[model samples]
Target chain A: MSFTTPTIDWAAFAPIIIVLGAGAAGILVEAFVKTPATRRTVQLALSLAALVASLGVIIAQWAALDGAGTVVMSGMATVDRQALAWMAILLVFGLLSMLLFASRDGGGAFTELGATAPGSVEEKLARRAGLQLTEVYPLALFAVGGMMLFTCVTDLVFLFVALEVFSLPLYLLVALARRRRYLSHEAALKYFILGAFSSAIYLFGVALVYGATTVTDVNMIGTAIVNLADADPLLLAGAVMIIVGFMFKIGAVPFHSWVPDAYQGAPTAVTAFMGAATKAAATAALVRVMFVAFAPLEWELSWLVWAVAIASMVYGTVVALVQTDIKRMLAYSGVAHAGFILVAFAGLEGEALTALPFYLLAYGLATIGAFAVVSQVRERAEDGGVGAEAVRLGQWAGLGKRSPLLAGSMALFLLSFAGIPMTAGFIGKFEAFSAAIAGGAWPLVLIAVLASAVAAFFYVRLIVLMFFTDAPEGAEETIAIEDGALTRVVIYVTAAAVLVLGILPSGVLNLFADASVLLVSVGG
Target chain B: MNPMNYVILAAILFSIGAAAVLLRRNAIVAFMGVELMLNAANLALVAFSRIHGELDGQIMAFFVMVVAAAEVVVGLAIIIAVFRARQTISLDEPAELKG
Candidate 1:
């Protein structure tokens, strides 16, 4: 028998190739470059260039993808408006977060000597000599590349691969904090174990689906469901398991045990990047799986989605109300935001699709901005050196008196998180609720509204603590500010974007509406 | 000899792995639990491929193996880091950041 190779479309695959290729080259730089300072500069420059270049390609392809979509690489990936929108968001988030990573207040966010024990002489010596783990740049690029692929893959196999590719880097990055190595390492271990466990279940689900449907391609799975005479129990079980995997990534209830710890332990920069980008990537993939591959089973899956959404909202809000650590609070708040995005899935139509990407963009911008503010506020060491981030809510007392600009930005982000009027979060909530209502899911929206109200209390509490409260008596630990141009740019851009998107959402709303359609088939 | 039996055995192995992950206190053993689960998935894939009369499932099993291998590399590095820091591989030791 003669075999013919399938024709490949390299142009459709350029964005992923460029990002991953740059990541591999970055690894080479880490090995060959002698000086840590020069290696960091090279890595930072290459990473920014790669992300910006990918964004350029995505924009150039955006207008061309008007109708159904292009299926490339023998049906492994689909290049369409939905994928393009997520790619743009991920690339933008990557570029902005790279700024946060490269920003240095001497120690920056990453450990100087990751392999050395936390308080050992070798660690201190390495710190004194000013060593930096420039390897983080390549890991971030790898994660970004995986996220881009996660949103666009057309097959379950590719889905699993993308899921792991993104996850492994994050697992490593979570452990690289310059301070609090113990907590960081522990968090990484928990995240790795739990993440791997969830993915295995997802793979098993894929096996069951293949057994029931006789196909591995997601589009074919959808077709198989319609072509089959009856819905197999195995098929439903498989779907739920696959969704369990996605929920773990999204940080929904029951699967959200990892979020708070990981968020609290990871360096602020990594948390900011992962919080904004990972949720977007997972939500994009979830929408494709639910809308494109499992559209026919909407009636069966609706209740599961609603249950997870409601539980996530309630649990996230209630738990966040009691959190003392700012990062942990933000992590719980992120859980609630994930629920809000999932609520749109209650409406399994184009409207929900339109709402999610827009909501992700709005939420992502505010999150990255808030974390940038978190990174700026440092603990003052005895020798006048800058320590780890000041994470305790009490530590933020009277911050407005010292750094009004930083306090104001954090307050703005909190307002956005609360979905208050005149912020991007408000617009995000409006579209999500409206879409759910249109789908006849008003009860879920009502529950969501109540959770948002409860969530608003916690966010407002932080705001009040920052602006209104006096520094407690003998609270000698002052909040030290590290001036970095990179972080300053991130803060200003995010703050301004939040206000602009809040004020004029029509332009982006229309884009999301137009790009909501999924091109889901084996053929282009 | 039947493929259905092999699928059942894989399911049992997967359950054990899940139990180990949930109940084990040792980080290394917990990690081994995850590895077991991945291998179980590979087993199911091969069994399913045999019944379906196609090689796609077998190919998927290969991919799973490679992924599992990579995961082991990363997982071990993390476990080693944790062990060096605390002088223990027990999951219960690190209790600094908890609600």
Candidate 2:
């Protein structure tokens, strides 16, 4: 038998290609580049340029697309407006995060040598030599590329591959924090094991799905379901398992044990990247799986979605209320945000299609911006030098008095998180709640509203501490504010985006509305 | 031989693997559990492919194997790094970050 070759649409696939290509080139640079300082500069420039170029290509493709979208690579992937929108959002996040990664004013975020033991002589020597872990740029690119692919791939096996491709890099990145080396290592180990375990479960689900339907292409599976007289037990089990895996990535409850540990343990810059981009990508993939592949099972799966969404909101908000550490608080807050995003899935209606993307965009911006602010607030050493990050809740007291701009930005992000009016979070929550209402999932929306009100208490408490509370006696000199140039730019961009999207959301809302169409493979 | 039997055997193995991951404290053993889970999925895939008369399941099994191997590399590296830092690989030992 002769094999026929499937043609690829190179232009349509250019954005993913550019980012992954840049990642491969970066590895070569790591091998060839001699000087650490020069290598850092080259890697930063390369990563930023690649992300910007990919963004441009996506915009161009968006303008050129006429129909729903085309299935390329013999139906292994689809390039639709929905996927393009998610790709653009992820690229913007990558651009901002890359800037954060390159910021070195406060001794940077990643360790000089990942292999060296913390506080050991070799670690000190590496630091003294001015060495830096510049490989993060490439790893981030690989992750961005994988996440982009994750949004668009059509086949279940390809989806599994994309999930791992993005996850592996992030697992490694979590371990490279300059401070709290042991904590970072523990986080990586836990994240790696749990992530692998979830993927295995997801793969078994995929296999069972294939076994039940004799097909792996998502659209084909949907077609098979339509033809079948009854839903096969294997198919249902597999679908649930598949979604469970995605839930772990999204950090939803029952599968969310890793979220806080990983978020708090990772370097602030890497956390910012993962917090923003990973959720957006995973949510995008979930929307696809739920909407395109498993829409027929909506009746059966709605309860699962509702249960997880409510659990995440209640559990996340309650735990976040008591977190003494800023990073850990944000991690629980992320879990709550995951629930909010899932709220759009309640009705499985068209409005949710627009609502989810907008919600993720708003949430991602606030998360990245907030974390950037966290990275800038450092601990003051005995000799008056900046040390590791000041993560305690009390350390932030009277921050507004010392640096109004930083504190104002932090306050803005916190308000956005609370879904207060005149911020992106407000519009995001409104759209999501309205979407759920339209889907006839009003009860879920009611619980979500209650959760939001409770979540706001802690968010506002932090605001009060920053603005109104006085620094405790003899603690006035404990917090040092470092003006890292790159971090400042990230904060400005994200905060501004948050406001613009909040106030004049019509432009983005309209764009998301137009891009909500998912293209199923007709060939399959 | 019924190919369905193979699928049932795969399911049993998957449960054992899951049990090991949840119950075991040693990092290496937990990792082994994950690998076993993956291999069991491969068995199910091949068995299903045999029953269905399609190459897609077999091809997917190959892809899973390659990805699983890559996972082994990364997982071992992370476990090694943790060991070097703390002189132990017990999952219960790292209590620094409260789950």
Candidate 3:
């Protein structure tokens, strides 16, 4: 018997290939490069180059493929404007985060020797010698590749593979922080156990969905459901399980127990990257599954989405009010932002399609910038070696007087998080609420507005503490600035983008609107 | 016996695995629960493939095994590291990162 081979389009798959290749090359560099210093430089350069190269390729492919919606490997993967837009957004964030990752003179944010016990003589010696773990570069690249693939895959099995690809690296990265090693390790354990559990549930859901429909391709399943006279309860059960998996990734309430711990425990650079990129990637998949594959069941499933949105908003906002730690507070704020974005998801219509990507972009920039500022504000020790970040809310009082630029930037990001009028968060909230309103989700929008007002109190409280309060005695220079050009670039660029995207939103809004057309079927 | 029996068996196994994960305190045992859950999904896939007269489900089962193996490597590495540091494999002991 003659075998017919399925034709593969390499050009359509270039961005994923380049990023994964860079990750592999980084591993090789670690093995071959004798000097740790050289390996560190090489890995950082390689990661940045990979991200930039992928961005360039995405732009090149955008014009001819814009709105074309081509399915590359039969039904395995689809390349469309929606996937392309998300890919571009993820790559930009990845590049900025790498700069944050590699921005320090004394071996940066990661532990010099990750396997060494924290506070041991070996660890102290490694720190004094300024050893570095260049492996984080490759791990991050793999995560980026997985996230990019996650946004575009049409097959359920491929989606699971992509989910694991990104998650495993992030679990390891969360454990690599230089200080608070126990906390980091604990967070890593919790994240891994829960994350794997979620994936298993997701896979079980996949099996049942496949069993009910006898198909693995999302579009095929959608088609089968459309043809069936009565919808199977098994299909609905599978859908809810899949939604839970996505919610876990996005850090929505009930499934969000890991968010604050992981955020507080990880190196700030890693937190910046994962917070923004994971939300974008998971939201992309959620939208694809809901709008493209499960559209017919919108009425039955919309209530589930609404309950999650409201729960996340109310819980995140109320809990954040009492958090003394800035990272934990930001983590809760992330939960609330996830809820706001879920407002768009609950709409599950053409209007939501327009609002979701723009909201992710605005939210991502503010988050990365805020975390970059956090990374710089460290506690000054007697030995002149940088201590861990002073994250307690009390430590931040009178920060405005100490460093006007950093504190001002932090305030800008916080305002954006609060949905202030001149920040991107405002536009994001406005678009999301309007979309929900148009989709007849007015009550959800009203609750969201009330939640936002409640959330504003904490953000303003922090701002007040910074600018109005006096520095608690002799704590003037305790908040040491780790001054790095790369970190500053990350802060300035995101802060500027937040303001620009807020005021002159038309340009980016039109771009998002153009890329909002999702292809449900192969080559639609 | 009917092929549907295998599917029912798989479902029972999956529920037991889920219960173990929720109820168990030991990190390794909880991890084992995840493995059991994955294996149940594999069993279901194989049974369903037979009923459907296709190789797709069998192929997916193989993929699941490879992914599961990789997961064990990472999971064990993490558990061992935590155990070494704290001298306990119990997840309940590490209450350092709450709320």
Best by TM-score: 2
Q: Ranking by lDDT, best first?
A: 2, 1, 3
Pull out the clashing pairs in model 2.
Answer: none
Query: Candidate 3's residue-wise lDDT over A1-524, tens digit each?
Result: 69987787878899999999999999999999978889889999999999999999998888777455677787788888888899999998899899999888333778898878777788889878868888999999999999999999998888989999999899999988877789888989999999989998888888888887888888887887787778789788888888888999998888888899999888888999989999999999888888877777888888888998999999999999999999999999999988998899777377787798888888999999999988888888788877888888998899898888888989999999899988998998898889999988999999999999999999999999999998888887676777788899999999999999889999988877888788766432
- Per-model DockQ against the true two-chain complex: 0.82, 0.84, 0.73
Residue pairs whose backbone atoms clash in candidate 1:
none
Candidate 2: DockQ?
0.84
Model 3: how far residue A104 lies from native, Å:
1.1
Candidate 1 stretches with Cα past 4 Å from truth are A474-477
- lDDT by residue (A48-68, candidate 1, tens digit) is 999999999888888666575
Residue A512 in model 2: lDDT: 91
Which DockQ-derived CAPRI band holds candidate 2?
Answer: high
Better of 2 and 3 by DockQ: 2
After superposing candidate 3 on the true structure, give the runs of residues whose Cα lies further than 4 Å from its correct spot.
A105-107, A522-524
Model 3 error, position A507 (Å): 0.9
Model 3 has fnat of 0.49
- Residue A453, model 3: lDDT of 99
